[model samples]
Target: MYQQILAPLFGSLGWSAVAAALPLLVLFALLGLVRMTAWKASLIALAVALAIAMFVYPMPVDQALLSATLGAAFGFFPILWIVINAIWIYQMTVTTGHFDVLQRSFSRISGDRRIQAMIIAFCFGALLEALAGFGTPVAITTVMLLALGISPMTSAVVALVANTAPVAYGALASPLVTLASVTELPLADLGAMTGRQTPLLALFVPMVLVGIIDGVRGVRETLPATLTCGITFAVAQFAASNYVSVPLTDIIAALLAAGATVLLMRVWTPRGAEPPTSEPAGSRAEVLRAYAPYLIIIAVFVVAQLGPIADLLDAVTLKFNWPGLDIRDAGGEALSLTEFKFNWLSGAGSLLLIAGLLTIPVIGISARAALGRYAATYRQLAWAIVTVMTVLAIAYVMNTSGQTATLGTWMAATGGLFAFLSPILGWLGVAVTGSDTSSNSLFGALQVTAAEQAGIDPMLAAAANGSGGVLGKMISPQNLAIAAGAVGMAGREGDLFRRVLPFSLGFLLLMCALIALQATPVLSWMTVM
Candidate 1:
């Protein structure tokens, strides 16, 4: 088996770390500075990473190729698979003319652009994040925001930003679960600490969404509703994660947040906001029919996640060790190097596809037309698929070649200030991998290790990894591609990244401060014992 060499070329950790980071820097410069399309930038970055893996890190050629292939397979099977089918269901609704009715139903709730954003992007998006995650919220919510007459760019930005708070607990709290597993901490402790940290962001995000949607006026006029949504969500999140159930944290929080927003609107309307021009109310049957697609989605996802059904579906899962990619870390611990966990039956993508197929008869579309829509979606998402795959391949290369470990090892040398720097590792992990769960798996142990060295609570440090990583989702290449596709801005992933970068960085800084304070006596009481 070929082993990775962290400082293969320069024999210096500092120079090796910089060499390891060159591909990511190239990717960011190309996408953020040179304004390259995501697909092209990803391709170039993958090329750079391969060269670095083979030369600077000195990974064998066969291992490098297999790693990239495995990453691409994973990108297609689960990640892009979910994106394609979720958008296909939305397209099916549009084809059947139900989307218009759905839009009217939402407008009936509130005509104000700000309120619509709060409902669709913040509240409803959280529900999606809970159920499906992995770009599902960005894919679905951006489209919904567009249907409500928001600009495509604004819709994409709002969806990305609103997706943050729910993400630590997303996919049934998979990120926290991964953190617990990696750090050997109790799930309850990790959940509670994450609960403490992310709820602060939960309480702040709705206001930020409003600010993004309509500037100072939006925040000023909709202050009551925004505060209500954020505070209720935060309280519910903390209670659910700490006391009730970790997996159901986002779901319960989302339901309560939406309910609170509706109740608040019953007595208060924002000043200067005109009532939406009343549209003809559909019959109860018509409204339910219009919502049948989502109802089907909920049913399929729920059934698929049921214990027995999930077990049966998981039985069909295909797991394989990546060839020639196994490597050990500095401490002689073997890295968990595997690839393409093809959860064919139980995956969210399959559930979404089942939901779309069920929609065909409900929405009055023939099989032929539904197939046509599927093909059209494939054509539209062609570049996005390539972008995701290439980026993931780059991530795989970085991980297998020890480049990621190099960066983390260098960061872990921060000593006492490692508390402030802990979340940055998480942020970097997710920004590179496009997944909070993946980030936790990558850096969870590192956080605990660094915390022990620096004399801080390992639980708090590990939780910070997950909590802060959520911010990076907004600017991740996979998310940018999904957001671009959702808004019909296929080649403009760069634009979406640029729009969300400020919010991502701003939240990262806030999380750093929160984590830093928790490490000290000032906010030590905030953490779970």
Candidate 2:
């Protein structure tokens, strides 16, 4: 078996870290500075990563190529699987003329665009995030905001920013579960620690969303409603994750936050509220028809994920060693990632596909028409498919070739100062992988190992990895492609990237400060320990 090495460049951790970072630097420069289209930039970056894997890290050429193919397969099966079906459901609603009816129904709740954004993008988006993480929330919510007359770019930005708070508990706390498994830490402690941290971010996310939608004036005008939603969400998230259940945290927080906002709107109205001009709101029956698809999705997921059903699904899941590629760590242990788990029937994409089929009759569409829409959806997402697959390929090549470990190892050399940089490592992970779950998997054990060496709390460090990774979601190439595609701004991903990058960095800094403070006696009590 080929073995991984931490410092392949002159046995110097510092130089190896810089060499390992070139692929990512090339990626960001192309996307951010050069403003290149996402697919082209990703392809270029993938080439750079392959070069580094073969020459810099000196990995076998065949193994490096095989790793990329595996990642590409994964990116399609699970990641793109969710996005394509979710968007197809939205397309079905549009085809049935129910989407416009849904828009009018939302306006019937409140005329203020800002309040509607608070409800749809922030509150409702969290519900989607909880149910189906990955790019599902971003793709679905951006289109929803656009339906309500928000500009495409603004809708995408709002959706991306709003997706953050619920992510630690997203897909029923998958990220926390992954972190727990990787670090061998208590799942409850990881959940509890993350619950404490991300809820603080939750407290301010609505306001940030308002500011994005309507500038500082939006925050000022809707202060009461924003405060109400943020407070309720933060408190409920903290309570559910710590006291009740980890997986239920986002569901509890989202429903309460939405309910609280609806209640606030009853007693208070914001200035400059303009009702959306559309056809009259649909009848109760039509409104129910309009909402049936999303309700069906939630039902399908809840049923599939519960007790015996979830167990049966897992039993059918095929886990096998990846073909023709085997590499061990520096310690000579086989890599777990070398094995691929194919959850064909139980994957969220398959569930979404099932939901799409169920939605056919509910929305008065036939199988023939639905199949046509499905084909069209595939054509619509063609480039997004390429962008996502290539980005995941780049991630796998770097990971399998030990570029990621080298960087993490170099960063961990900072001793006690590693606590402050812990979140940055997590941020970088998600920025590359476009997944908090994947990020925690990549860096969770590294964070805990570094924390132990530095005499800091491992739980705090691991939780920080997940918390900071959430912010990086806004900048991930896969997310940018999804958001851009959702709002019909495909080639303008760079614009969306530029719009959201500042907030991503600013929020990451806040998370870093919070994590650092928690490592000290000042805020050490906040950790679950």
Report backbone clashes per prediction.
0, 0
lDDT of 2: 0.90
Which lDDT tens digits does candidate 1 get at residues 486-507? 7789888888888899999999
lDDT of 1: 0.88
Off by over 4 Å in 1: 323-325, 331-334
Model 2: per-residue Cα lDDT over 46-66, one tens digit each: 999999999988999999999
Off by over 4 Å in 2: 275-280
Least accurate 10 contiguous residues by lDDT in model 1: 323-332
Show pairs that collide, candidate 2.
Answer: none
| Cα TM-score per model | 0.98, 0.98
